[model samples]
Target: MANILEIKNLTKIYKEAQNEICVLKDVSFSVEQGKFIVFIGPSGSGKTTLLNLIAMLDKTTSGSIIFKDKDLTKIDENLAAKTRLLDMGFVFQFDALLPEFTVLENILMPAIIANKKAKTYAKYLLEKFGISHLANKFPPSLSGGEKQRAALARALINKPTILLADEPTGNLDTQRKEQIFKDFAQTAKEEGTTILMVTHDIHAANYADKCYKIEGGKVE
Candidate 1:
């Protein structure tokens, strides 16, 4: 597999008053195509910040992030938005489903934003995740597990090569958490999606092809 993303000497520093809070320092790594990579660490260890930089959701204090041979750190915000919408899929800790929309509608949002029809793919994802029956149901009507499944389906609708997940199973039970990671692993295998996920759950490590432990602003 080719290198999908490469980070060299990444660093993030926040100066609060006279004290400088360094979130990340001289971090470096590479992500390959179709790999399930995980970053595990304690709170405030810069895992999320590193993910955000890789996702192009934030600027690095100092470093170079090369995605597909292009330097993301130098891209303008407009390009960043387009890159986020077309190249990356995100599954946040809260699921972030719209309350007023049904499962299928929520999943179709990215396509709609891109002015494309996604009904066929949306239906396929729902079926793939065993949530086709809930297509018309709103987020509030779904269980924690069901909502997360729907969120996963939504993330895949755009067929993003990269999926960035942050604590995706934070609100689910043990069984549900295990099931979600299993689904994620299967998705990566069959769909050729490169997943980079950050979680505090040590159990999540079992499903990853490679794991990195971040501590004290560094990756090991």
Candidate 2:
């Protein structure tokens, strides 16, 4: 399989007053298409920083982030925003669902933002995730695991080429967490979506095709 994403000599530095903090130091890796990749580390490690850089949520100090052969580090904000909306999907620790919207509506939000008609595909996603029964339900009425499943469905509504997940299972219990991991692995294989996830939970390693350990600003 070809590499869908590449990170080379990536570094990030944050300046606070007179202090300078380096979160990621010359980190590098490549992700193959349709593979589930996970970065596990303790709090304050550069795992989240790495995902932020790839998602273009944060800028890199100096390095290259190549996605589909395009240097994301060089793209302007407008193009980056378009790339994020059209080609990439994100799921963070929180479900981030709107309480007023039905589960189906929430899943279609991204497609709506992109001016695409994807209601049928959204329904399919819900069914695939085993949450089709919750289509008419509001987010507040759903359980923690159900809400996360809805969030996952929302992320896939656009058929994004890559999925960026940051501690996506953080709020779930053990059973739910493991189920989410299984879902991710299956999604990667069946949907052909390259997945890059960052988390402190070591259990995620069991589901990943490639696992990296990040600590003290380095990956190994």
Best-fitting candidate, scored by lDDT? 2
Per-residue lDDT of model 1, residues 1-220, tens digit only: 8998898999999888899989999989998988898899998898788889888877799989998888999999999999889889999999999999999999999989988889999998999888999999999999999999999998988899899999999999999999999989998899999998999999989999999999999987
TM-score of each: 0.97, 0.98
Each candidate's lDDT (Cα)?
0.91, 0.93
Candidate 2 per-residue C-alpha lDDT over 1-220 given as tens digits, one digit per residue, 9 for 90 to 100 = 8999988999899989999999999988888999999999999997778888888989899999999999999999999999999999999899999999999999999999999999899988888889999999999999999999899999988999999999999989999999999999999999999988899899999999999999999988
For candidate 2, the lDDT comes to: 0.93
Clashes per candidate, residues 3 or more apart or on different chains: 0, 0
| C-alpha positional error of residue 200 in candidate 2 after TM-score superposition, expressed in Å | 1.1
* lDDT score for residue 122 of model 2: 91
Runs off by more than 4 Å, candidate 1: none
